[model samples]
Target: GPYVIPSETPRGEKYLSRIKLSWSTMATTASCPPPSVLLPIRTTTAGARLTSSHGSRAGHAVTTTGGAAHARPPLPMGMARALLPQRAPLLRRLLMAGALAASCTCFLLVLQAQASVPPRYDGFAYGVGAAAWKDAVLVEAFLDPLCPDSRDAWHPLRLAVERYSPMVSLIVHPFPLPYHTYSYHACRALHIANKLNSSSTYPLLELFFKNQGKFSNRATSSISSTAVTGEISKMAAQAVGNSVSEFQSGFSDMRSDMAARVSFKYGCTRGVAGAPFFFVNGFLQPGGGSPIDFSTWTSILEPLVAHHGQTIEMLTSV
Candidate 1:
């Protein structure tokens, strides 16, 4: 059977999206040049100039009439993603667009064949590693802290995790939704609270959900100012015992961003058509519930969990 990519994903739009989206699925990192690099990086240069390779290898030269850039601007945080080898060229191209300068030269990135996609497990991967699962199969929820459905469902998830802490790892990944200005902040707040190692992810999740109603109904809305969103995220995270600055830093951590992006990417690859998505092992369960209640999770999840480890291993190879 041909593989399926979810519709909400940018990857489904074209070959590049499809390829980058499949990097983790294929257990490979796409081959491409690093983003922040000098075009013709030369070691021996007196002034603003160009050097193609090391050892001052003979290459073209361009003299700068004015002052040179003190430093290269940082690459966009999410650009250095680990994707599958065959699919990475597209993302590399996307990042290259950001590097346009007045200097005129044909930039060619020599991609090396190194296939290593970070073992990026998603779902509430923030501040610190998530609480370990017990015996029951874990339902690691990669939530959008500002999402109302996530707020409602988190209660039940908290209960399940606590009751079956011995059986399952209820990992809370409050990932930022691209559209919601507060979503990322909310998630980061929870991550900040986690710095203490025993904060209640449940309360943190709930507070954000309750206030989320005031944010906006539209998908692509911003939370007005960084100050307001930061305050709300800080308060929500504090409910679970996280300090403000700690919460703030974790909320903005680049690694946190990368982890969330990885989660979102996996959601696309795993057929996660919408939020409140559930990835139980490799199979996807409906958000919050299926057509029914707890039985829905049970009926569909039990058998799959029973044979999951082996099946997961098999799926990875595909």
Candidate 2:
């Protein structure tokens, strides 16, 4: 009927968030007969004692609705105690205490983990690139759209994706930290371009990065969803060779924030502390130069293209 508080219980965050200490009380009735005495006869005592053949037994009937429906005899050895008031109070106190302690411990552990992981993006993630280098190779690049080093590593991948076309697919992902102020906006703008034209996404992205800092971080981050649509529409006019209407449509229908989240998540998963990070076929490339070396990238990709060619030839013949 009333609430019960448990003491000394292990703590958990979820458990503490929305907790209700309630007890459903039920009532019970019992009936019991008094014990019958038997008299014993002795030669000196000369008195004979008689005992009843049927001994008194206690009986009970309980109902959840306060036992209003029925009543029953109580057993001589049986006891009925209210669970809510009698037992639940003590147990609730214990439980609440333990829960608080456990929740605190887990919170501390999470803080420790965050400390070691190097905060990448507590707010919005920015400055990473990912794309498909064709079915032959999946390219994952981490970059700071604002960082010169990241831009350096990014240019070659963009070029290869353009030059190679279907021979390769480029997937660009980034991990932007707070230190790089405009990284997120830059990455988001590129993502908006990618959404507009899946085929020519790479080159358009190169152009955007090539023409960086047109908008301030505060300006881009605060941009409305409708405004993003308009911005992407302008991309097609900037030597983008894509339909302005189509790009705007994609932006209108897209979840740009979630796009940023996925980009950040992937980069962080690959142990990226900073940009520009590159993973060619799950392999990490060193960063420190503007525009990654095409030779270094081809050293890995060319072989993959060759293998892919053989595979296609064999399959077609079959």
Candidate 3:
């Protein structure tokens, strides 16, 4: 069977000639329909529209007047598939490879972003010359002022810091636990005390730890936050030898709240999940989130102190 041209006009003749020439060139190297099957191709001022003629509604293929071709449509499912070139396999493979590469790049970027050390805040350090010793071992304790576990751990921690003296530095970070309703207020009071007198920081913290039961959820359930804050301010003022009015003024100050918020956020960056969590030399100490005995503290500090001394001696010799 011979192919039939659809029209007798000059434009139709031109289209027929182009189709015959394209069919002849493509038949040798590309898969296409037999000579009797007609492929519907229309040319407009905008572009050329190509459609599969053999009852296949798979998709359309568009080409610009300048001969630049866009993405080709998928072929028909069964016998009509041969009417177009078989390019799906290669295109699918390329798309899959691109997606896999993108996924791997994203995964690596996430890992790189997550790989970092927590930052240090020197202002929270306690005791004389705490932040002065550059080579000393750093002991960062993230504690909740009203947490029972934090109260239990404070004694041993204080003793350990005192025993190490200038060889170890201890920084107390206030991480108020949500379940403890008044922990934020207590921590805010401690920050205020710290600003009034750095020496009063530890004393005020010790007092809060001792009287935590008074500010517990059960005890303060019936009282307003203002009453609790006033009581805390009075205790802090007494402990720090400051007037109650001065302490109350600082308690209501926004700077104290900002300081407490900064400390809590710093703890979060270090992945502090509970009160009394500890980090030695920027590394989290296992089993430190609980109440560890003085002996346990000694066991951990002895080696670190010895190492510190050795490093100092070596640097001095150098």
List where candidate 2 sits over 4 angstroms from the true fold: 1-134, 162-165, 194-204, 213-254, 287-291, 313-318
Candidate that would win on lDDT: 3
Model 1: lDDT equals 0.51
Residues 16-59 of candidate 2: C-alpha lDDT, one tens digit per residue: 22332111111123121122111111111222122223332223
Q: Write candidate 1's Cα lDDT for 54-73 as tens digits.
A: 43211223333354534444
Off by over 4 Å in 3: 1-123
lDDT of 3 at 137: 82
Which should have the higher TM-score, number 1 or number 3?
3
TM-score of every candidate relative to the true structure: 0.47, 0.45, 0.63
Give one digit per residue, the lDDT tens place, for model 3 in 260-296: 8777777777888998899888899887569878999
The best-first sequence of candidates by TM-score reads: 3, 1, 2
Instruction: Go through the candidates in order and give each one's C-alpha lDDT.
Output: 0.51, 0.53, 0.78
lDDT of 3 at 146: 94
